[model samples]
Target: MPHDDFQLPEQPRPYVQPPLPPKRHGTGWWIYGFFAAWICLGALISNGWSINFMVITIVVTFVGTPLLGAALFAATKSDRR
Candidate 1:
């Protein structure tokens, strides 16, 4: 076909968009709720109530937080696939 005689089709090209990220669910919600509950409970339990506040905080932060995080991570990771 001659250059002048040949014309490209006027139709639009087909396009595809990338898939969106997975929606947040049990993990996200559980994390937020757990943290919030801890803070509120800690405040109520320690403030003006006991002198063992520091010890309680340490145990919760070091032991509880890690356990909770690990559980959430495992649960979420499995759900991903």
Candidate 2:
């Protein structure tokens, strides 16, 4: 067997990720507040009090209110002295 007959395998290069965009501070609260506001608007529009609309309003309020509250809480917590 000739040594020159077998060529050494090429080395693999390390994986590199592209640079990420800069983070936006305090954006979470704005997003959560936006959704929460939409939910409130929906509830207001459904004030006719139909059963289905009432259920939807309740569900959205249940979910959105907590999310908005959490975001607001986080924003305030981050601002503490």
Candidate 3:
């Protein structure tokens, strides 16, 4: 191609990168929460809802599950290219 060609532009457009996909950590926790709720309900009922056990169950299931989920999700990130 000749430099004097009319079809050629004096400057080319700069390259731009596409944005990354949104993190899925929130959705994953929702799924885990649903299942954990069912399992916790079953266990609590099986134990006849003792006050001490209920307290422990609520804390571990609601608090621990999300913390563990976040750590796992963060550690194993996916690339949605």
| Regions more than 4 Å wrong, model 2 | 1-43
lDDT of 1: 0.64
What clash count does candidate 1 reach? 0
Model 3 lDDT tens row, 1-81: 575785566556354223333455445666566656756675766676667667766776777777776776666555332
Candidates' C-alpha lDDT? 0.64, 0.60, 0.61
List the RMSD of every prediction in angstroms: 10.6, 12.3, 7.7
Error in Å for residue 61 of model 2: 0.9
For model 2, name the residue pairs that clash: none
Score candidate 2 by lDDT: 0.60
Instruction: Show model 1 residue runs off by greater than 4 Å.
Output: 1-36
TM-score of 1: 0.51
lDDT of model 1, residue 20: 18
- Candidate 3: lDDT of 73? 65
Q: Candidate 3, which segments miss by more than 4 Å at Cα? A: 1-38, 41-46, 78-81
The order of the candidates by TM-score, greatest first, is: 1, 2, 3
**Which candidate number has the best lDDT?**
1
